[model samples]
Structures are given as C-alpha cells and as structure tokens.
Target: MNSIRANPQAGLDIHMLDVQFIRDNLEAVKANCKNRNVTADVDRVVALDEQRRQILQQQQVHQHRQNEISKLIPKEKDKDKKQALIQEGRDLREKVAALENQVKEVEAELKTVLMTIPNMSHPDAPVGLTPADNKVISKVGEPKKFDFKPKDHVALAEALDIVDFEAGSSVAGQKFYFLKNEAVLLELALVQYAFGKLLEKGYTPIITPDVAKVDVLEGIGFMPRGPETQIYSLANTDLCLIATAEITLGGMHRDRIFDELDLPIKYVGMSHCFRTEAGAPGRDTRGLYRVHQFTKVEMFVFCTPDQSDGLHQELLAIEESIFQGLGLPYHVIDTCTGDLGGPAYRKFDIETWMPARGEAGEYGEVTSTSNCTDFQSRRLGIRFKSTKQKGTRFVHTLNGTAVAVSRALVAILENYQQADGSVVIPEALKRWVGRDVISRKGGISG
Candidate 1:
C-alpha cells in the first residue's frame, strides 16, 4: 500500500522478568532492578499478580456454577422449573464472561509492570552503572607505536580515493557514504572472510532480511518507533529496517518448539543494517564511525540453557580471534550490570584501537556478545522439548558480532596506514579483496 501507515508503537518490548519468579523472589528481583538501573515496580506487580489469581478463582467458581445449572436445566421435569434453571445458567454465563474480562485486565497490567524488570546480571559481572565501571577482562595485541605521524582513517580514505562522504551526504544524508574503489572491495572481503571464519566454526551462514516485522523487533527486545530508538520503523506499516541481523535471526524460531536433538542451532548472518542513529553516543555525527547504515556479520545461537554459557564464551572468543587476525589492538570488557541491556543476562564487548577517535587515540567498541538466557525465548515462545522432561522449556539465545564492517574498516584504515599515506589490507582478507594495499595511484579507480 502506498498510503501512510498508522499507530506505530513507540514503546519497548523490554522488561520480561518472570512473574512467578518475582512472586517467589521479590527482594532478589527488586535488588536486581536497582543494580540494572531500571524502575521495576516489584511490589505493584506482585499485588496485581495476586489479584489476577483471585480473579481466576472467581472465574472458576462462576464457571462451575454455570456447568451445574446447565446440567439441572436439562434434567428438570417441570417445564417452569426447567425455564428457571435455564435463566440461572444464562446469568452464570454472563458473570463468568465478566470475570474473564476482569482477569484479562489484571493480567495485562501485571504483565506491563513485570516487563520493567530486566534479566539478572551474571554474578561474575561487575556491579556498576556505566562503561567506566566495566572490568577489563583482557587486552590482546599491543598497540603499534608509530615512528612517523599516523593518519586517521578518514584522512587516509580520502587520500586513497576509497570512501566519499561528500557524494553520500549529498544524495542521502549525513553519516551515509559511498565506499569507492578498494574500500568497496575491502567491505566485500571482510564479509567473505568473516563468513568463512564462522563456517569453519560449524555455523550455517545466511543473509537475513534488512527489514523485519515490528513484532519481531520487539521479540528481540529492540524498541521501535521511538524518538530515542535506534530502530528505523516504516510509518503506517508493520515493519522496520533492522539495526542488526539479531532481530531477524533471534525471531527465526519464534513460537516454535525444537526437539532435544536440535539442542544447538548456530547461525552466521550477514545483513545491511539500518539505524536512525538516535542512540549514537554523545550525538556525535562523525564519519563511518557513527553511520546511518552499514553491513554487519553477526552470529546468533539457540541452545539449551546448560549449553549457553559455553556458547557465549565461544562467541566472544570468535570475535576476539577475528580482530586478532586483523592485527588490531583490542581488549575485552565484561559489561557492567547497569549497562547491560534488558535482554542480556551477561555481556562482553570488544573495543579495538582507533588512532583518531577523539583528541587522541582510544579504544572504541567494535563487537558485543550477549547471553540472553530465556529472555527472548519466553517472549517469542521459542521452546525445546526433551523426552526426559514432561513439558517444553524456553531455549537460551545468544548473539555476537563477527564483523561490523564499518568499524573493521576504521581499525584497518588507521592501524595499517603507512607513513606514506597507504593502507595495508589485513592479510586474512587479502585474497578476497585482491589487493595488498590501498594507495594513491594504486592502478584501480581514481
């Protein structure tokens, strides 16, 4: 339809704490909310949950009375008595309907409140509110000390004639760009290299849709249609351009039940990601560093709860290995509880060396891996069946960035810039990019 869309939702699908869990462990949930820096009305949710149960009980009572009256209506020999019983049954039916509606109202409100509670932080995760409190897990590959002045990626790219923000901004808007010459080749090579790496690690590679239904975005805990939302939603439509492949990949098994044999399903997804950049740090509208759109190679996994912790580490390890292969100076950060998003039970970030991030060189986030234990699965209704278990259990979900191509470009362009204004391609991606260096007059396009 060419018509304008209507009533797009501006709220988040965040806050998926278990109601029964909260009922049993109210203090713990409350404490977790405080640690995570979110408002969780634990007391109010508990109160409403209690009321919800009471309404259910009342419904049952009404239904039971209706059933009895229905039976009496058929059996009564006196016509007048039979008619009276029928009227009673009708009244009971109406009362039961009213009780059901009231119960729905209570449950809806309870659920809304309960959604404010986030996943509990991993006990090993540091307790803090921001990146400043994040603990450094490890630093890999020492930063190269240049004898000559090092040029930032922006300047190097311009000199090499590989990236054009001038053309991009004119056509689209700021933070959008055209990757020209070797830069374009480098982007493709990064994708191919990352895909090959994940394939070697036994992942099935796929290219996900750049757009997904709004509900799918919510299921993955990506709040859409908000002024502060990173997600870019289509107006009057049911879809939004994805900020990450995670939204589509995480929702793949939504409302599905997997058998125990398929206990682990790991996918390597590549997609062109779009974001409003509304959540960009410090409102900084700079280079490809804060872009409106970019290509990403992401890894997503659906596994049994017992398997997710190991998988989480494996994902992070893969991310670390990728940057290491590129020879970028980087470090692993154990994300603090308060900084962990609503869906993340535990998270780790990899920050790579950026020679010209600010006034001086600093580490900036390049990749993130999260173990969203049953948070997405519960809301998405993705579960697994075990013969040993009588009922299904929600699967644990995990996502890791394999290569955020734009940032990888940033690291490469800056880190590999020769004193002569040339940039050497990462050895691992050379074959696919078909080049060893991007230099002025390098014999490709001008």
Candidate 2:
C-alpha cells in the first residue's frame, strides 16, 4: 500500500453555524455549546471573525488604490510622475497581499473554532450530561419470558455452527466474524426485509460505495482523521472506509441545488460499514454487539427546513415499524443534548431488548435518527431554490438506521431463542430466508 499524503486542509470548506449567526446570537450559541458539553472558544471565534473582516476590508481598499495608481501610470506624460505612480502601485499590491494572507490565517482559525461548536439543540430536547438523562418517549412490545436460561448470540451461534468467529479472526483480526449457514441467509433476509419496507415508503433504494473521500466525511460531520475517530482511513490515500451508509448517502448530492418542487428527497441505502471502534475500550466487545465491520441499511433525506422536523419524526416512525415487523421489543429515546454530537439538532434512538446482554437482559441501541437542520448541508453545499423565494437556502439533512445487521442479529438470536437450542426467524424475513427456524443440524423447518 503506497501511502500518498494529501493536504488534510485542502478540501475543508466547512461553513457551519453561519459566522453572522454566531455573532448576532452569541449568548445563545455559547449556551448551546455549554449544553452540548463542547469546549469551543466562542469569544475567540467572534474576535477572529472580526479580524478577518477588517483585514478583508483593508485588502479591498488597497486593491482599489492600486487600480487607481495603475490607471494614472499609463496616462502620465512625465516619466518621474509615472515612475512614482508605478512605485505606489507596487507598494499597494504588497500591502494587499499581506492583508489577504492575514485574512486567510484568521479565517482558518475561525473555522477551526467554529467546528468545535455543536448545532443548537431542539427546545424540547432534554439538557443532560449522560445517556441516563435521555428521555424515554415510548416502549413498544414486551420482552419475551424464557422458561430456559437464555443464551447470548455468541453461544447460540456456536451451538448452531452458524457464525465462524475463529475463521474470521484468522483471516482478518479481532472484532471480525463471518456468518455461515442460516446466519448468511438471515443477514440477506434482513436487508431485503428492510429495503422492502423503505421502498413502500417511497424511498429510492441504493447500494452505496463502502469508501469515501476524507472531505466527504468531514462535510458529513465525521472526524475522519483523529485520535478519537471511528472511521478507518485507507493506507496512503485520501479515502476512508465509511462508518455507515449515512456518509455516502449524504455526500451523494454534495454541492447540489434542488428546485422547491423537489423539496424532499429520501433514500434507503445499503452498504458495508467499517469502524475502528477506537477509544471504546472493554465495552460490548463480546460477540457482534460492537464490531469492526457490518452491513447496514441506512435512510437519508434532504429537505427544506420546514420539512425536516416532520421528516425526522417520519424517519423515527419508519425505524419503529421496521423493528416492529421483526417482533422485537424496543423503546424510543429522545437523546439528550450532550449526546447529540456536533451536527444533530435533535436525535432519537431505539434500543432493542437483548435477552443476553446482562445477568438477564438489557436494551441495546439498535437504531437512531437525527435532524441535522442545515448543519451538514451548509458544509456540503447542498442547497435548494424556491420559485417564490429569491436565493438558495441550505437543505436540512437527516439519517436513520433501518437495520445494523450485527446488532439486529444479536437481538434476534437472543430474543427468539427456543429452549431446544433453535432460533426462530421473524415472519417478515421468512420469504427471503426460505425458512421459519434454524436448528443445530443446520436444518430449516416450518
């Protein structure tokens, strides 16, 4: 792998939280950052922005003077006078160059500080510091009561010889595994089942690339190259293995402008997601709960500001429906402000009941939907123009997980496990899986 180093700053044109918006709403932006637990120098951003503007004004003034001197030099009949004008023009040019450099330096610093400021939290979103503070919106379905001691997905998969972690480790490394026999069918079935549901909802189905450029990832609010980054950068390239279909789906229409009539565009994308799982030490390391790679069905939408809130709810509803179709017990959570990260104005998560998670069972996050509200669109330059309106406005971006195959599998195997060491396939997936049950003998039965 030839490692070619590219300038990390070359494509980072992030225009997050318009500088003017921050300048005008300084208190509000500061409070938002405090609530989000983000440590950004809001005051420094304002100062730097002011410096940049002043330098730009100076540059403009010098350029204007330089142009005036150039005109005078060409018309001057006296050689000494013309030479004086030319010298003045050269001096102005140097000053303009110096001011331009200052503007760039100031703007770069401003952008860096601005990147640390998170999106404003929705008014209704709970203000908290931890997941424990997240508000539970609703719980759907009841966890099944197993007569026999329930086994985790790892044990269940081993007993059925359906997943080969050893082979995967030998070929790849830790946090890697291969689905064999019915598990393979189950993964394909889950993808088909989720895609079918999304299609009915009028979403355009797409299979996206597994990798994307670093700029694309940054535009989508992912820190692609950092100590705490979850993304996997390819050796010697600007490309990175996508952590989710969200990156590719959102990057698909980068710099695109839509007509008002095409206000809302929805896509259900399938792709293999890769993550380094960095900084997450000793948490959900067992089985497939937290892994290096997995296939996922992701939903992404680009819409106007007015449409984003409603579309966000619709995304949540769709996620609920998908899990419901699987007969999985789960609950919806209104994610707290501190947990919203850098882009999401508001977010909702669905935690599916995993019977083998703890001493008995616990709910594990299986899906999430967020309303980014122009945060990503501004960075990616995705905008829309209305016939009634004059200029283009940044489109709001939203994304949700229809299915994370690995976590879904963990939930399915544990929840649907039978006393006889058999796993029952959800009715929604039976058509694609070609079976209702998976037994130890690798036999499928009705």
Candidate 3:
C-alpha cells in the first residue's frame, strides 16, 4: 500500500486533483470509492493535508522571525548583540528548511493516497459488480450460423501454418508467437483498415513509441511498477514497455495548453503493445485471444468537458463501423461501476462473437471506449482556453481501441474459414491482403 514514489518529481502527473477538492468533497469521494469497490483512505488525505498546511505556516513564521532578526542586526552596534542575532537568524533558517522537507513528505504521502481513489462514475452508469450486471446497450450484427463444423483460430492457424507458437516459446517465452504467412498480412491489413477509417473521421494518425517513462504510464492510469502490474519494466531504468498506444499518445500533450478553436483534438495511434500477462492464466489464453505482445491501433481524443460524452459515443460508433465493415457480429455493453477501473467516468466495451471461445461460441471483448472526463488531462496538465472563456480548463480525454490486430485476426480467421480448409478474407481487408482466400497450404499463393 505504500506506493510513495522515490523520485523527487514523483507527484507531477499522479497528483492532479486539488487537495481542496478532496477536503470539500470527502463524503462524495468516499461514496465513489464505495461504489467502485476501491479502498482509498479519504480521511488520510485530509489529515495529512492538515499537517502539510501546519508545516507551511510554521515555516512562514520562522522565515518572518529570521527576516526581522537580520534587519535588527544591521542597526545593532554591539558586537555581541549583532553576533547573537546572526546566530539566531542561522538557526531559524535551519528550522525553516527542516519544516519545508516535512511539508514535502506530507504532501507526497497525501498525493499517493489521493491518486488511489478512482474517478467519479457517471450517474447514468448502472451500479453492479460483475459481467451479468452490465447493461446490453445493443447487439450490432447477428451471430453467424455455420453449415460446416467450424474450427477455432488455433486449428485454422495450424492448418494454414500462419502462426508458430512452439518456435515463439523457444525464443521469447509463453504467450508469445510469430504471426506467419497470411496472419502477418492480416495483422497489417487490420492496422491499415483501422487507420484509414480513423483518418477519414478527422483523426490525426501517429506511430507511438513502444516504451514510455514510468510516470507517463502512471498518468494514463496504468501501474508501471508494482506486484500486480501488467507492465514490463527495464532493468535499472525508468522506462516500461507500453501496454497500449494510450500511454504514449496521452503523454505527448503533457503540460500543454491548447486553444479552444483547437478543441477536440483526435489522434489515432498505432503501436506494438506489450504486457506481462502476469496473472492471465485462463480459458481465454487459447491463442491470439490473449498474448504478451500485439499490434494495436488506438483512438485518443482531447475535447472540452461538454464534448466528452458525445465524443465517447463517436468513438464507439467508429469501433462498430470497423467491425461491421469486416462483417463481424458483435455486441455493445455499458460497463458497470465495479468493472469500470480507474480514470474512466463511463465505459463501453465491444465484444465480438468468436465461434470457438467455449463449447459453443461466446463473445470476447475486442475494443473498449471510455469517457475519462479530465481525469487524464488533469494528470498530464493538458488544458484548453477559448476566446470567449476567461481561464484555461482541463480538456476531457477519451481513448478507444480502433483494432486489436490479434483478436481481430481471431475473429476473421474463425468466422471466414471454409469447409475446404481455406479461409476467406473479410471484404475490409481484401485490398491490403490482396486475393480473397488464405489457402490450406503454407503461404497465400495462387
């Protein structure tokens, strides 16, 4: 629980909430913690803040006394009197310095505790703790009905020689694989398709760095260092492998101010995301369904507070459009309070139906969009001001997965598999992947 960072500038992004906000809304913040099932000690922030303030006051008093003594020493003619005054001034300076250090310790402790608290949930979000409690907003496309005994992505990949997990494990480790032949082409197609769609929607595309500073990861609500972190850390360094494009893209605008006319800046970032997959040992780990590394196209937005909800929906719509373009069946769910983790005021998840998830087919989460509502912007110090506005306000931030190349491949391979063992490509990927089918043999050759 003691996560006080040792870095001198540790609190920059992680401590964006005003201490005054915690002081004034103690009960509400506590209520939010209860709703989200988080264990943040709200009372601790208040108590430590009081101590910080007291230390500040003591330092100020000591400073004033030192100033007075220095002034009086200049006029005193007696050598003993002047010397004593100078000693007193030196002692006061030491006392002030000690108090200042105490203030820093108290403030740092306070910030660590405050950042543990989750953002306030949207009032419209349903109250629940599990998947069953999530509200089904709508089902996008109807589930596929197959005449053939459809095989999962694993079997299809084996048949077509599109993935090499055994070779991957020998080289890297488990949950790592080489996307061979058609799969590699499919990965690129998904990236290009998602990027093309997002670009058409006025989103600026960027290829983000795969690694980020630990603080930038923390600012975007990811734990870069911890017992239960999904992040991969470098030895004796502040850098960690990013889990998504969200981290680098969000960090790009850190400590930046924007004009209101430039409000709602949309970015589509592509990156090779890495995660430890630390505790993810479950049924979902069959194939590309869960992995340590994957290519992803992520959507990030920075808009005014009033624009967040609408932009969130727009992000969702784009996700649906991409899936629909690929002719995949999926459903949208309004994520519940307990499931909505830190930084998201509200969240929507898109689950695409995979024909071989279980005995029968099941839905697996493919993409998710969240209305972060200044939670990340505050942490990163991103603000916007309008000509009609007085002061700059934190711009709301949102992020959505345009395409997770691996999972999209799973959906594509299983759904488009032919009885003859060849896999028909989705129309969306036809252009990039060239000919329509991935043949039963090695490569996608004529």
Candidate 4:
C-alpha cells in the first residue's frame, strides 16, 4: 500500500482520528484519494476541527476561573472581598454556560459537515462520477439471444400471474409489491439455496433482528432514522428498521471486544430488511426490482487486517457462484471511487442481465460486497488481539449480499419465461420449491 498526503481541497469527512492519522500520513491519504477518485474536504473539516479546539480552550479558561472563584468565596478575609468573589463567580458561570452552548452548537454542525465526507477509495477503484463510469471487470455466460420482442419484468409478471403490482400499489403504495405463486416459492428457494451454501462454506447461521437502536445504526455507518435515508423508523421507538441484514449483524457486537483466538468470525443472516427508498423516488418503481421491504440472506465477516483482502475476494466469489447457479447472464464491475459509500474501501457489484431494462436488455444489480477495513470496527469498538501483538487492534469488517429474494425472483421469472406464459424454475432450486415448472393451467386466475 502506498501512502500520500490527504488533499485539504478534496471533499472528505474527517474525524479526530482521521485528522491525526492524516497529519501523520497526509501524503498517503491524498494519494489514496487520487487513486480511488475519492474527494476529501480536508481543509474544511480540519479548519472546523481547529475552531472546535479553540472554543474548547476558551471554555476551559472560563471554567478554571469559575473553579478558582468557587474556592475563594469560602475563605475570603473581608466581607466586601467575599461578596465580590461571589459576584465574580456568578458572572463567570454565566459566561461559561454561554460558551458551552456555543461549543455544543459547533460540535453538532461539525458532525453534519463530517457526515458528508466520503470514505477513502481503494487504490484499484475506477474513477468516475456515476454508475455509467463503473468499469466492467468480467462478463460471464453470453446474454441469451432472443428472437421475439422481450417483455419487461412487469409485463411478464402480469402475463404469468406471478406478481401483483397493482394490488401491492393499492394496499401499500408504489414500490411495494407482492410475489405470488411461483415468485413466492422462488424467493424461498433462493434463500434456502444461498443459506445452505454459506453453511457449507463454514458460516454460522443467524436470523438477525430487523430493528436496531439509533446509536447502533450510526455506529454501523448508517444515518439513524432520517428522511434522507432509505430506512424506515418505528413511530415511537428509538429503533429504525434495517435497510439490510448488515445493520443488525454489525450491531450484534457493538461495544464489545473479541478474543484474540477468534480473529475471524463469519455469519450468514436471514432477515426482513426495510428501506424507505427516499432518494430514488421514481426509479425501478414498476416491480420487485426496487421495493420498500424485502427479505435477504446476508454474509458478514470480521477478521484481522491481514486476512481481509482474501476474505473480500472469497465473499465476492460466493456471490458470483450464486448467480452462476441461477444461470443468469451477468457481469461483474469494480465500483468507482466517487460511487462507493462511506463504509466501503473497495466494492464489487454483480449486475444480472434484465431483458426489460434497456433496448438490448441492460444489467440490473443483484448483489454487492464491500471490504470496509477497520472503519466500522473502530466506531463499534470491535477489536481482537494476536499473541504476537502487544495490544488489541480493530478488526476488519466485510459484508456481501447472498440473496435478495425479491430481486432474485425478478431475475428468475423474467429470464425463465416461456412462450406459453409459464416459468421454468431453475433445476438447482426444484427440491426447495417442490415444483419443476409453473404453467398457465397451474397459474389459473380467480
């Protein structure tokens, strides 16, 4: 890894630790951002931090004066002197209170500013502003050549009676849909298949909680219960519904330290994830491609820094294998620096070929995996010790999607449709779904 100074001009959110680290290795942070296309706002964040420290100094001076006056008032030699000391203490208390309020305000503003800064990108990340700029690293299984005009997932869903978009809209508004008949079964089959594979690969099975505390949510790098987020919050609770199993899984070990021997822990979790889809108002609102809520099997691992890179690739392989088993035409892309989220140092996404998307059938993202390194571990206080090391070090964390049931159903249903309006369930999932095919007669309507 190369080290470079972080550019103060680059738009990045830096904390106390980030500043200290950058100050010690400014060149490394800057070079990393340049390589990853990560924009860091070092100048602004650092200046505000400096302001915060200056405010603290003023506050400390006032507090010290108050403390000295407090001690003096009790032992004044004369009445006038004692009265003056008491008055001075009251005035000092007022000034200190006002300064404290200002400090709180500055701190809050600083937090908001810092939150906008993106994480440093990996050296290998492609540089671009949008998904269009994402570099395709690999393509697998040539896209199926179709002779007839292909129906989009929505049209095919209606024709096959496998999805209920209208009813879903009527009941839960747009972006909320119901998977009927084969679609439902396919969802179950996908989750089971993915979960079983994860188990075979030495991952512990867990069904995590769907709701998490606000602090836990923030600690895991998600905005806690906000309109700008894609997460839903309970009306009267401090908990917010998770956008993915990663939230709950990551929160599981919050404020805890792990034993040195347990340097690596892997978990496969199944959970009903909820998202408000706040920013994406109209995109992918037609069907299961984008929904307010969905079930997913998520893979999360905590390991020592030395093992993270290998584990990251392993997680990516598992995602690719699941897509391969489904027999869907897809491509893998290395996410760019500008597009990667706050927690991801590097990310890879699997986009399946969706016949309904574009003129020649565009790809739709099915799964993504991120190597967060120690960013999350530091915030969560999850550290592990090694026998050879003097003290514990923050562990690296990674998360990848094993199966997102709703979207997988979309991929399978659209890709497997027959000319006769029936669906052929993938052979790998037959035993789990208990049906080989879904034909029109079996899809009889009410």
Highest lDDT model number: 2
Range of the 10 consecutive residues with the lowest summed lDDT in candidate 3: 1-10
Candidate 1 per-residue C-alpha lDDT over 1-446 given as tens digits, one digit per residue, 9 for 90 to 100? 00011111222222266667787888888888898889878899889877877877787777778878877776789999888888888888888778777876776687677666788778898999877889999999887888887888888989989999999999998889999999889999999989999999999999999999987887788778545888887888999999999999998778788997887999999999998877566654667787989999999999999999999999999999899988899999999999998899999999998887776788988999999998888778788999999988889999999999998899999999888999888899899878788889895743
Candidate 4 residue-wise lDDT, 172-255, digit = tens: 987778888877878888988999899999999999988988766776789864558877878889888888999889878865
Off by over 4 Å in 1: 1-15, 67-78, 225-227, 279-282, 443-446
- Report each candidate's C-alpha RMSD, comma-separated, in the order given: 5.0, 4.3, 3.3, 6.0
TM-score of decoy 3:
0.92
lDDT per residue for candidate 3 within 12-79, as digits (tens), equals 43354556787898898888788888898989888997887787777778888988998899899999
Tens digits of per-residue lDDT, candidate 2, 1-446, equal 00011112234553678877899999999999888888989999889877876777777778778878877777899999888888888888788777766766777777788878888899999999788889999999998899899999999999998899998888999899999889999999999999999999999999999999998998899998777999999999999999999999999999888897997999999999998999998988889999999999999999999999999999999999999999999999999998899999999999999999988899999999999998898888888999999988889999999999999999999999999989999988999998778999765432
lDDT of each: 0.85, 0.89, 0.87, 0.79
Instruction: Provide the global lDDT of candidate 4 against the true structure.
Output: 0.79
Give the Å shift of residue 255 in candidate 2. Answer: 1.5
The estimated TM-scores of all candidates read 0.93, 0.94, 0.92, 0.83
Once superposed on the true structure, which residue ranges of model 2 sit more than 4 Å away at CA? 1-14, 67-84, 443-446
How far out, in Å, is residue 57 in model 1?
A: 1.7
Q: Which lDDT value does model 1 have at 381?
A: 75
Model 4 clashing-pair count: 20
The stretch of ten residues in a row with the least summed lDDT in candidate 2 is 1-10
Clash pairs, candidate 3, are none
User: Can you tell me which runs of candidate 3 are displaced by over 4 Å?
Assistant: 1-16, 64-85, 388-390
